[model samples]
Target chain A: MVRSKFFVSLISSLGIIALSVAWMPVPDAAAADPNTFNRLMKPPSKRNPPPTQDGIHDPGSIGTQGLQTPREAFKPLPPAQSGNYVDWVKAFDAKKIQPRFDSKDPKAKPVIMDLTIVRQVKGSMPDVIFPHKQHTEWLDCSNCHPVPFVPQKGANQMSMASIMLGESCGVCHGKVAFPVADCRRCHTETKGKATKTSAKAAAKPAKSKKK
Target chain B: MQATIHITKLRLLPVAMLLLVGSAAVRAEFGDIVLNNVSEQQGMRPVIFQHWFHRIRFQCRVCHNELKFEMRVGATQVTMDQISQGRFCGACHNGEIAWTVENCDLCHTGKPGLTTKIQGGHETKGPGIW
Candidate 1:
């Protein structure tokens, strides 16, 4: 009878151990293909993979061989901590990459707007400083206006939760531009101690051209 | 001896269950979308659309506005017939702007038996309670 009781306890303990192991948070790499996991959390070695190996293009395709690898292309660009590890804003400012403003008309120049929008957030987190100069360098105003963001200030209500759900700034920030992991990049303004640049920008009213 | 054998069999149950749960935890990275609306039925792999690559070349307005691609996944019924006629993907993929659709494997690179879904990285929601 004692042997049977010992076996029951052993089986129960083993079951508990198994349950705990199963419930333990699996590492992101273990859950999926490391290469195909979230790019934001990718190790430095896997950040800028080749065209064929990046999982976007077919490895067997002949065209994949001809395409340039991100590592080679981003060598001269400003380095970053996440995503493709290329600081696109710095690269644009430094003239390392001049993205065409208009796809159809190569000669068309972007209507550069030097503006900034400061969003005050609750809690100890720093306020957000949305810079139009950096964004307009590569994108047109229509890319964001009237869609994810309204032209007028305070017209759109935004929150971290909505952004995570792929709304508002998240439409691009976490997808094409940069992942939200780089929080300090946007939330740069401290409470009651606004930087000179942001303070000057906040003074000017947002100018929106009606179509 | 009999109790020992029974204990081993019972222990195997949780081990098997753990494996089952682990296999179900499939996930995808940010900007990756698995488009398999009609691929598997036609003996083709689902297309893995990478938003990062295309956005690097053209602005969001180019595809979202000019191409009229809905923001939601699987919202646009992209068909080969529409593509060949210079609509949707064919606008730039018609041998002049970008690669022609003749090379099928380039776009359709997703694993077999997957469905249309955005493989968005959930971690982008930021840490802690919002």
Candidate 2:
């Protein structure tokens, strides 16, 4: 009877130890499931604390510049689409763009530019497409900043021939930037007909433009 | 043995609660945003502040770490002489890395109580955060 009593006590103690271990707090060094941890990461409060400079996607307070910054400098010119390449480049200078916080943003909220292709200038507007992200990577805010960019829509009468002849994009396209030789680089085609036009001029422009 | 387990749990519960409260206080201490340093010169306070909003644009080396901006605000003691040297703001503001500080409107700004309109809606210049 004494031996039986001791065994019962030992078994009970072991059972109790098991229960204690089960009830103990689990260390949360890492999460078991990824999805659960994602939702769990949300701040405890429902209220979104005010936008910190580093908080939102927009580079806020950490800054802003007003029309004149409460100061004066020849009263900023009437904001307009650039009349010339220099005007366009100057406009790009005014908007100081810091490198982005989120690299994915350009791809996510992309701005699509309508392309106009022509057999030649003054011929037909050939519908060329300009990807905002593609151009933004190679350039800076000044690349298309002030009086260059009209505050409103339907501004800046940019010509394709001028751009091709080393004005705006041609500044780097034929030399440093992606060359104009690649037709499909900017245009889409049903069966590569435009490719022939692009190729014919490609080999010649590359050779003579350097001089 | 059972009593020991109960006591341990009870003790842990209060400690956990205290830790939670302590962390909340630290977050609240910072309030809204983290400002690096404030600059003052003879009662004139330019936002010598460096906020993270503009920091990540380039690297800290571009200014504080590389350009060697004094960690303390106004410590660099920027003057006309230094402006011409291409140090501090002159590093980028010298018509190269950035615009030059030659113009009165560029850095002096001439605004008495104007803040920047950047992330914080301050309408301040590029130097708001520093």
Candidate 3:
């Protein structure tokens, strides 16, 4: 009985480990479940989805004053706060323009624009204004060139699937390049529709409309 | 038998590469990019142009209006010869506006790439593998 119990415990422990990895978080490029990105990117548009806005958000986690979102309450290079990436993910900013580099290094060129990434197999890529000049400040040309980039296009199997899985641009964008969690920063629609409609209202609390 | 298989595989490799080098990567829905909608052509679609950084310098009108170029790839008809003359891309490729055309290798050297790096000064490793 003792031996069998030990074996059962071992198997159960392994099962828990696997399950936890599921929630541990997808790599920067690999992408977490879209429902999560949608929830984060799309304000609490409906009741089914949880609220991600500033005031009254995650009220269960805090009091009613409003959730302390960096993008909402804090702006301008983010105040000196003491929180992890979660704090950064929950915030949004309209003024802080996204950073990018003019890629003079041929090898650092990305495989595809985010607009056409295959959602079925590959996750959506953040439309990073990739900072080429900035990256060269630290990395070597061989790091991305020759090994990852081919001498021409379509030679590399770089897609959202590969990138998120850490193949192409995602190799760095997810791990180093400011991360892919900030949705609106990179995916800004030139023709403003949502923001023009709900700039401040997005941060306000939605009261229970009387039936 | 092993020797023959190895040689045969090696011989067919170039042909396979030729087909692959011609096509761009399968499309993605998002990222910093240039989109050119291929028009009037069947094999290659119009190039999707991305204004990732070009937007930093001149206004959209700089290229769209001042240059009188269309959004579509072939729509502008930037002949390899014309670029060398400062016509389409040549207008600025003279080391002042952009890279010099004498370095045809900059844009036209590689096999048809799905994408190309517009910036210069740093070393550029071609993105094609085929």
Cα error, residue B2 of model 1, in Å, equals 12
lDDT of 2 at A55: 29
Model 3 misplaced stretches (Cα beyond 4 Å): A1-211, B1-50, B109-130
For residues A159-195, could you state the per-residue lDDT of candidate 3 as single tens digits?
Answer: 5455554456654444323344444434433233323
- In terms of TM-score, which candidate is stronger, 1 or 2? 1
Q: Pick the candidate with the highest DockQ.
A: 1
Per-residue lDDT for B70 in model 1?
A: 67
Please give, for residues A1-211, the per-residue lDDT of candidate 2 as tens digits: 5455555555655565555455443535555565554554423231223222122211222222321221122123222211111112222235333333223232332233322232222334333444343344333434344424443334545564655644445543432233455445444332334445563343343224222
Measured on C-alpha atoms, candidate 2 has an lDDT of 0.36
Model 1 clashes, total count: 0
Report the lDDT of model 3 for residue B112: 27
Higher-TM-score candidate of 1 and 3: 1
- The DockQ score of candidate 1 comes to 0.27
TM-score: model 3 vs. ground truth: 0.27
Chain A TM-scores in order: 0.70, 0.29, 0.30
- Poorest 10 consecutive residues by lDDT, candidate 1 chain A: A202-211
